[model samples]
Target: MAQVLGGITTSHIPAIGMAMDRHEEDTPYWKPFFDGYPPVRAWLEAQQPDIAVVFYNDHGLEFFLDKKPTFAIGTAPQYHNADEGWGIKPIPPVTGETELSWHLVNQLIDDEFDMTVCQELRVDHGLTVPLSLMWPGNRYQHIKVIPVCINCERHPMPSPKRCYKLGQSIGRGIRSFAGDQKVVVFGTGGLSHQLDGERAGFINKAFDQYCMDTLVGHPEELTRLTNDDLVEKAGAQGVELNMWLAMRGVLSEHVTELHRHYHIPVSNTAAGVLVLENED
Candidate 1:
């Protein structure tokens, strides 16, 4: 049977993608941020999972105010990157595992999670940036992907509890697939930093650290926080952390955090990264 090897969580700040695209890693402004990923790259090289189920939000690139699905799954054979109004990030297209994606879709619906199925989708920096950070130098070409897009851009988004439960459903779906594929799930976004309004540039390092520490063992405690609370404390965009809960739910109840990297003010965001493995 297919096995979920583990899950990874990280911030998907667009500026990080730009820094990489422009070859600015050594610059003083970006060096600290860039320094956090070598270990992640090394870890991924060793794990070498065959598939990555990416959970990220769209920032008006594919879905706009006209229509937005709270939960969408990409079933396409391949997904291309979007411009996001600033031109597309130069990266190889993401190949998809269509059969597994369809199976997951059916399983999720059977589990009472309504998801928007997309046969064609364009990924934005929120998805591509993390992929780049994890599998740099086009190593992403070696593995297939299943894009799981969650709606965190608008109000009435999925609640923290709902997101966690959705992740549980995804974990069940992956484990039930009849194959020997090695899979890794990703929850991309957050670590508390706001972008916009008078409170813009707001960040709560304490709350971010608490989340990183607690999510490995007691994700249930995080569900107690409301969206308002996340926005107020972590910043507006920080609410995207809800996506990480889904990634966490896909793992074994007990997980060993193999790697963690956190850095401040990565383009007005508290960038965080973690690699977790299901305890054998």
Candidate 2:
């Protein structure tokens, strides 16, 4: 069986990647921002796991509201980093671990988790931004990926409890996977920030800090809160926390915080990063 190497939690702010491309990791405006996670960069290199199961919401890039899927898994042989106005980064397509992906897809259905499987899909910043941060500079060269797209941008979204349960199903899926390899799971989203008409600049530092530490220590209570509570306190856009539950779900109550960071600026968003792996 494959052992899970660790988990990564981070925000998917599109601007972060843009900053990196401009070589502004040291610019006063962006230097300290990316530098906040020296430990994260080192941990990623050291672990060098074989596969990463990434959980991120699609920004209507691949799936639109017309046919949004609550949960979709990328089983494609290769996935392209799409160019949504900005030119595509042109990274080599990420090869899918089809063996394990198919295995888990069937099992997730058997377990009663509604999942949509796709053989070909283009992933936008929702998946790529966090990836560029976690595995910068050809990180994809070493690790293959399984993309888990959540429907956060759309209304009538999945419930917090359901997202938590989905994580449970994923943990069970990984445990039941009959393969001998190492893997890392990542849940990417926000701590607290909104992007609506007038509420765009909202930030909830208290809740952001609370959710950061609580994700590894007290996920049950974190999952209990509703979208309204997250919207009102965490800002409406911050409901992206639903994506984080996927990471929290698979983790045991005992896990160490390897690295974390939080910030808010552009488009009225709370940008953050949290990475955790099993202690064992």
Candidate 3:
């Protein structure tokens, strides 16, 4: 049976990707944030997961405001990346695990989760930035990707609990798969930040810290927060933490926190990266 090694959560701000494109990791403003990734890369090198199931929100790439599903899973043979006007150069295409994706799609629907299944997807920075961060220098090409997109940008979005449950179901599905592939999950986007209206450029470091520490073992505490509560505490776009919650949902109840990094004002967002290894 397949084994889930662990999950990783990280901020997917467009600026992070652009900084990498320009090779500016050492620059004063970006160094602190970029420095947090080397340990994660080293861990990945040692573990060498064969597949990455990315839990991220789509930022108008494949799904737009006009037609967005609360949950979507990609089963494409190869996923493409495009410059969504962020001026971030597109990375190399990501290979997909079609067999595993189809298996999970069946498992999710059977488990009562309505998922929009896609055989073609154009991934944006939300999915790619974390990949580039963890597997720099084209190393990501070695692993197949399965994108699990949550609707964090629209109203009627899945609540934190719902997303968490979704992750749990995915975890079960992965464990039941016949293949022996090793998997690592990714939850991308947000610690906290608001980019528009009266609350533009808003960030809550206190809330971000609380989430980082709490999610390690007390994810249920976070599930209690309603979407309204998330917006109030985490900011509008900050609700992207749903991806993080979903990532946590896939993890074991008691897991080791391998590494965590938090920085503020990364292009008006609270940037964070967490690596959690599933308990044996």
Q: Highest lDDT, which number?
A: 3
CA RMSD, predictions in order? 1.2, 1.7, 0.9
Model 2 agreement with the true structure over 1-280: per-residue lDDT tens digits? 8777778887777777777677777877776567666777789889878888888888767898788999999887778876676654545566677877887788789989889998898887878877777767746656778888888877678888888888778777877787877888888877688777777778988888888878878888887888778888888778789888887787666788777777655346766777787865
Q: Considering only N, C-alpha and C atoms within 3 Å, which residue pairs clash in candidate 3?
A: none
Segments in model 3 whose C-alpha atoms lie over 4 Å from true places: none
lDDT of 1 by residue, 164-255 (tens): 99999988898899998999989999989877899999999999999999999999999888899899889999889888998998899999
**Best model number under TM-score:** 3
lDDT of 3 by residue, 1-280 (tens): 9999999989888898888888899999999999889989988999999999999898887888778899999999999998797588889999998999999999999999999999999999999999888877756888999999999888878999999999999999999999889999999999899988998988899999999999998999999988889899989998999999999988889999999998887898998989999984
Q: Estimate each model's TM-score.
A: 0.97, 0.94, 0.98
The list of candidate 2 runs beyond 4 A from truth reads: 86-92
The number of clashing residue pairs in model 1 is 0
What does the lDDT read for residue 112 in candidate 1? Answer: 94
lDDT of 1 at 68: 94
lDDT of each: 0.88, 0.78, 0.91
